[model samples]
Target: MFAVVLLAHGDVVRERKIAAHVMKGSVEIRSNHRELRARLREAGSVRDTAVEGIVERLDPLGPVCTGVIDGGVAFGVRVTVPYVILGPIPRETFETLDWPR
Candidate 1:
């Protein structure tokens, strides 16, 4: 599980907790050299590709916690596009929610 947030003009506008199962595709060689070459050609090439996954669950991200670093990765469809966490996070006014690391 990881937290995904949307930031606009240095403020957290929206957030969500996403639980996903990542699926990675692979190519294998079998039999002779001709088959291996064909598979290799068909596989093409990729760089810094984001892994595909199915979202198992989604929950709201309640309040922001200051001083404590929540566990999450910058997620996006394209690797070329950048996502950033900006400015100061607002302190949680209420009791802490059970954060999933």
Candidate 2:
């Protein structure tokens, strides 16, 4: 499983883990990769569009949202305080997280 960690500046607040395959499908959809979305759906990685809402609500800490996966970064809006790390991030990523101080 991978997870999404919510951050306020460098402080971690909330985190939610999800299935890696579901996360992959979500990243593709959120990134607007049309071909990959179709492929993921066909391959049964993503069942439907409802997964989008599920992933978006994973971190309801604030309004700001973004996705970072496979070292790729994309923001739904300009980066700012109270942002969400939409990761299906692996175990190694957990070790690198900026824990609350």
Q: Tens-digit lDDT track for model 1 on 1-101?
A: 23443321111111121112321221112224356455444432221121111111221233222222333343211112222222233355123556578
What is the lDDT for 12 in model 2?
12
Off by over 4 Å in 1: 1-31, 45-101
Please provide, for model 2 over 14-45, each residue's C-alpha lDDT reduced to its tens digit, 9 standing for 90 to 100.
Answer: 11222335334444344555664455446433
Instruction: Give candidates' CA RMSD values in order.
Output: 16.3, 16.8
Deviation in angstroms for 79 in model 1? 20
lDDT for residue 8 in candidate 1, whole number 0-100: 17
**Candidate 2: which stretches are off by over 4 Å?**
1-51, 55-60, 71-101
What C-alpha lDDT do the candidate models reach, one value each?
0.26, 0.39
What TM-score does candidate 1 reach? 0.17
